[model samples]
Target chain A: MVQRGLLIVLSGPSGVGKGTVRKAIFKEDGVDFRYSISATTRKPRPGEVNGQDYFFVTREEFEDKIQNGDMLEYAEYVNNYYGTPRSFIEETLASGHDVFLEIDVQGALQVKTKMPEGVYIFLTPPDLKNLRSRLVGRGTDSAEVIEKRVAAAKDELKMMINYNYAVENDVVSKAVDRIKAIITAERLRVTRVLGELDN
Target chain B: MVQRGLLIVLSGPSGVGKGTVRKAIFKEDGVDFRYSISATTRKPRPGEVNGQDYFFVTREEFEDKIQNGDMLEYAEYVNNYYGTPRSFIEETLASGHDVFLEIDVQGALQVKTKMPEGVYIFLTPPDLKNLRSRLVGRGTDSAEVIEKRVAAAKDELKMMINYNYAVENDVVSKAVDRIKAIITAERLRVTRVLGELDN
Candidate 1:
């Protein structure tokens, strides 16, 4: 019996290290999940390969996909559109390959609305104070920008109520372990395994 | 703040090796759960301690507990009563220590009615044919008794629909690992971690 694969959506507030944790998860052996590369209208940076870094597309083509209901979730920033394509995820899942999506909190919420069955995981910082320290340590933003970013993160934390699980990203390896456990547990769920049992 | 400990209920059909798996789980390091000792009216076998093996009680006292609703779940077989006391599980959980209950399918269903939040796992054989062979392999039972047991197991397997997880006991260690993963994943659920986040 071919069981449909799980859709794992990982999201968190800005600077919560979702990317680092996701990368670590893939680096580990036996973690078999297809990362859903998103489509974007933004210009690729130097040495960025098309279809590998992203499905780089024209603005008109992206708009056509949006109108066709082909985007699982999408967002616009600085006149550039970035969105998850629905077709690839559907086909991958149909073929019994789990798909992993790493996106921002807003995008995660949008995907949740479109596919509520997906396992929505909210990666969180150990604490707000720790998050602030990390932002300061980055040394990229000025005082005003840092304050604004912190405030935005605070608001985004509230969105965790929409997630199925909230994993504290205090340590990247620990977070990855929890994510792996979640996948293992999900596969054992009675609702998901009943089909296999019947066969 | 002391978070309430999880109540894990492990149940399955007859001859599914629930006790063997539960013992293995406790033998492993880092499994901090307390095994809930059951109160019973049956005479203990040799080498069985009162509090450790079973809380041996008289028929009068056992019936009194049943009358007082102190038994979380109970069954009477061959004029002897077997029951789980409600107080110990509640106290352990309130003290932030997880309690593990290994019981029959009927007892598990009863516990679920009282504590629906408990994580109920149903351990299944790889197949019904395998279960039949296992039953036949046990030299203790007559052919007639083995057939009856197999029929009863078939009926009990239907109860798996009410459980949160159904893990196949094809391999003892694999089933134990799945149960551990279920516990770990449950700890990270958003509903359980929200209070920690607020703190």
Candidate 2:
């Protein structure tokens, strides 16, 4: 029996270094994983490819997919539709490669309502101070915006209870190693293996 | 808040090399773990130390411990008492060291009833043929006994559903690595970390 891949949902507050940890995980060269791409009705920005940056589609096309249940989860923001394409995730998993959905907590919870079996992991900053430093390091937001983010992070920390695993991103490499262990352990889950056998 | 240790129950079929995988896991440095020692009323064989081999005790003493609810689990074989002591496991776990219980499926399930939160892992052979060869290689059992063990393994395989993880002992090192990953992941469980915070 062939084992199918896992659908992993990674959620965290902004500036938690999730992207850096994920990059480190992929850079290892042995982690067979793919990032889930979102479909959006919003127009692509400059230098952003339609399929690479986002699966840019018309509002009608995105709504049609949602109506047909092709979207894993969809939401309308600023009159633009954004959703996870179910077909790509299903296809990638059928091909025996893990798929990662690096979504926010709200979106991740929405996905859980649709696909409850997916592994939900929370990446947390070591502390709010470190998170503030990281946000400042990015230099993308004003001090007021960083303060708002820090406050929001406190609220998100409470949501850690909703996750299956919580890994502290004190060190990017250590955080990646913990996530890798989680994926490895999840692959050996009895329910997953039994499903393989029954196939 | 300090994180507590994990109670890990490792169980599988008789010939599945659970011991070897566990040995390899412990042989690696930085894995702070201890094996649960059982108390037995059976007399120690030559070259077997009382504390190192088994906690050799008189039947009266062993039965007294069981009567006092000090035994986590116990069984009688040929009028000899064998049981896991509760005090040592609690002490080891309190000291923040993972404790491995290498027992059969029956014993593992018994422990689960007492400690429902322990991580239960099932170690399986790659295939029935390999399991049979392993049983034969033991050279301690007769052909009839080997056949009985093989049949029992089939029954035990079904019990994998009761476990959290099922690791195939195809390569000893690989199996050990999977178990180590499980321990690492289990330590990051949200509930476990939450409890630490509450303290």
Candidate topping DockQ = 2
Candidate 2 lDDT at B112 equals: 82
lDDT of 2 by residue, A127-187 (tens): 6435677788899999999889787766776888889999999898898899999999998
TM-score of 2: 0.83
Model 2 Cα shift for residue A103 (angstroms):
1.1
DockQ (Cα-based) for each candidate: 0.38, 0.39
lDDT of 1 by residue, B18-116 (tens): 999999999878999998999999999999999898999999999999899889899988999989998889999999999999998989999898889
What are the candidates' interface root-mean-square deviations? 4.0, 5.1
Task: Name the TM-score of chain A in model 2.
Answer: 0.80
Separate clash counts for every candidate: 0, 0
Distance (Å) between predicted and true CA of B52, model 2? 4.9
